[model samples]
Target: MRVVLAEDNVLLSSGLKLLLNSQGFEVAAIAADACAFLAAVETHRPDVTIVDVRLPPSFRDEGIRAAAQARRDHPGLPVLVLSQYVEQEYAGRLLADTRGGIGYLLKDRVSRIAEFTDALRRVAGGGTAMDPEVIAQLLARGGDPVEALTAREREVLALMAEGHDNAGIARRLVITDNAVHKHIGNVFLKLGLSAGDSGHRRVRAVLAYLRRYGGNAPDATTPHH
Candidate 1:
C-alpha cells in the first residue's frame, strides 16, 4: 500500500520508512507535524497512513485529531494511529466517526516488523486492527454493559464489535443462524435497549465496555499497547 508516515521523532520516522520500504510499501510522503501530515495526504492520497498520535507544536492530540480529519475528508481511507499508550477516548472518537479501515495501537508494537506490516496491509484492505492491549484495557475499565448477558449472548456481542454480522458471528462461533439471532436478542434485552436503539446502543455498549476495562480516553501520551 502507498503510505504516508507522520511522526515528530525524526529518527524513528526514518527507520519506519525504511522498514516499510523494504516490505514493498511506497513511502509516499513523510511529515514531522500535523499540518504537513495533512498536506502530504492531500498530495499523495496514499492507500494507508501510519501516524504517530503526538506531533509537533503542542504535541498533544494533534495526531489523533488529524487522523480523524483525514477520515472525514477521505472516507474509506485507512488510518493506523500509533501511540505510546492506549487511549480509550481517542479510540471511541475514531469509532464514532467511522468504523472502516481504522486502527489504534502502541508504537512499540511496531517492533514486531512482520506483525506491524501485516496490520497495515489489513487496514489498507479495509479491515480494523486494534491493539489487543487497547481492547484489553477497554474491556477492563468498567462493568460490561452486557454483563447481564448470558454466555452465548456475550459471545455474540464480542463478535459483533469485531465487525462480524449475525451470520458471520454464527459461522465463526459454529452455531446456527437461529442461535445467533436468539443470542443477539438476548444481548439487546440484557442491555435494556430497544430495536430502534441498535446503533446508539452498540456505540454505547462499546463505550461502556471500554470504560469497564479501566480504560481512559486519549491523553497526550497513553502507554497502552
Candidate 2:
C-alpha cells in the first residue's frame, strides 16, 4: 500500500519510513511541515497517510489541520494520526468525520510493530483504530451519564470505542452473542441513542460517551516499548 507520512522529527520519520517499507508499505511522500503535508496528500494521493499531531512552525495542531483539510479536499481518504499525548479534544476533531477509515493512536504504540501495522491495515480497509490509551482515558474519567448502565453495558460501550465488534466484545467478556447485543441495546437506551437508525445511533452513542468522559486523565499503563 502507498503511504504519505507527515512528521517533523527527522529520526522518528526515518525510522517509521524504514519500518513501513520493511512491512511492504510504499512511502510515497514525506513532509516536515504542514504546508508540505497538504501538498504531499494532493500530489501523492497515497492509499493512506500517517501523520503526527504536531509539526513545524508553531507546532500546535498543524497535522490535525492538515488531516481535516485533506478530508475536505478528498472525502473518504484513509488517514492514521499519531500523537504522544491523549489530547481528547484533538481526538474528537479527528473522529468528527467518521468516514469509516480513521485512526487515532498514541506514538508509544509504534513500538508494538505488529499491532501498529494491523491498525494501519484496518484503517486502510475502512475501519476505525483507536488506541487503548484513548479508551483508558475515557474510562478513568467518570461515566456518570452512562453510570445508569450496568457494568457489562459500560464494558460493551468501551470495547466498541476500541474498534471491537459485538462478537469481539462478547469473546473478550466471555459472554454469549445474544448477551452482548442485549448489553449494547441497554447502553444505547441509557445513553439516549435509540432514536436513530442503528448505524447513526452507534455513532451518536460513541460520540456521546467520548464527549462525556474523555479529556480526564493520563493513560494508566506504562508506555509500551
Candidate 3:
C-alpha cells in the first residue's frame, strides 16, 4: 500500500518510513506541517496516511486538523494518527467522522511492529483501530448509561472498541466465546443500543462511548491553510 506520512520529528519520520518500506508499504511522501501534509495528500493520493497528532507552526492540533481536512477533501480517506499521549478529544474528533478507515494510536505502539502494521492495514481496509489506552480512558470518564455497565462488561466494550471481534476478545480476556457474547449483549442493553441500530452494533457501541466526550472536543473543521 502507498502511505503519506506527516510528522515534524525528523528521526521519528525517517524511522517510520524505513519501517513502512520494510513492511512492503510505499512511502509516497512525507510532510512536516499541516499545509505540506495536505499538499502531499492531494499529490500522492496515498492509500493511507500516517499523521502525528501535533505538527509544525502551532505544534498543537494541526495534524488532527489536517487529517480532518484531508478526509473532507477526499471522503473515506484512510488515516492512522499517532500521538505521544492519549488525547481523548483529538481521538473523538477524528472518530466523529464515523465513516470507518480511522485509527488512533500512541507513538509507543510503533515499537510493536506487528501490531502497528496490523492497525495500519485495518484502517486502510476501511476499519477502525483505536488505541486500548484511549478506549480505557473514554470508558473511565464516561457518564451514565456507560456508568451502568459492570466491570467485566466495560472490559468487553473496551476491547470491542479496539477493533477486536468476539474471538479476539475471548483470547485476550481468556474467556469463552459465549461469555464474550453475553457481556457484549449486556453492554448493548446498558448503553441503550438496540439491534435495530443503523450501523454495526460494535461500531455503534464505540461511537456511543466516544460521544460521551465528543461533545466537548474541538470541532473537526480546522482553519484551512
Over 4 Å off, model 2: 195-204, 208-225
Clashes of each: 16, 0, 0
Candidate 3, pairs of clashing residues: none
Task: Please name the candidate that would achieve the greatest lDDT relative to the true structure.
Answer: 3
lDDT of 1 at 160: 52
List candidate 1 segments past 4 Å from native.
149-225
Superposition-based RMSD of candidate 2 using all C-alpha atoms, in angstroms: 3.5
The full ranking of all candidates by TM-score, starting with the best, is: 3, 2, 1
Residue 47 displacement (Å), model 1: 0.3
TM-score of every prediction relative to native:
0.71, 0.85, 0.90
> TM-score of predicted model 2?
0.85
Which 10-residue window of candidate 3 scores lowest in summed lDDT? 216-225
